[model samples]
Target: MVNTSFALSSTTRRRLSLVIGAYTVVVFATIVALGVLSATASDHAPRDAWVHAIIVAVFAILLPMRLRAASRGSLAGLRAIGIISGVLFMVNVVESTLSMFPVWMRTEMIVIALLMLVSIGLVVRERL
Candidate 1:
């Protein structure tokens, strides 16, 4: 059986929570803003709304899982998820920029970048 007994200091846990919460808020806000802007700029199509809904759903699920994983001291799991999320977020920004989406999307992209850096830092710090 795999030992899942990794534990984090209280301070570390709190810090991690702060980082995760900030990332989640920024991501969710960005999604809502994009959804609203898209609805306003384009005719409300089922497909567009569906895409937004899917993004929102993914954010909803991933954010909680991230928090839970961090709290449980699953550093490996958190880092893996963070890397995947960061890459996907960066891709989303690149696609949006290329597709002529509004400049406001950059805000979310920056947040994701910061989160990615912090996650990498956390992974490294935990190793020492």
Candidate 2:
């Protein structure tokens, strides 16, 4: 059975936005927290801080645009969200296992990864 329908239900769209919104908030909070922690400690690496900064920036831009596109029934937006979520999920999982970050930050990576997983599932279900 081939399903060509790509329209996501309003409920699904709302849930997707909420999940992404939460993930974005958490990512921003983690970066802010890292900044404060780094300010007080000499152990944090500049490279790691820059990596997190870039992640936060990407999420900030994508969140709004993707949500708007999805609401408008854009398949490209849904596809992009799915691919981005899958890629970020892997990135977060790898980050969570790294030794240099604080345990709390690593835990936060896991949380973000879970959100990405949910996002992947949502988009896949809609597309299929």
Top candidate (TM-score): 2
Writing each residue's lDDT as its tens digit, candidate 2 over 15-110 gives 898989898788787677767766786465355755865775587578669877877877777878888899888988998898867677788889
User: Relative to the true structure, how large is the alpha-carbon lDDT of every model?
Assistant: 0.59, 0.78
Tally clashes: model 2: 0
- Please, what are the lDDT tens digits per residue for candidate 1 over residues 1-128? 88654675676566656766776676666667657766786443234434643564476467557657766777666565556556655655555454243445544555566765675566557656
- Clashes (backbone N, CA, C under 3 Å), per candidate, total 0, 0
Give Cα distance to truth, residue 113, candidate 2, Å.
Answer: 0.5
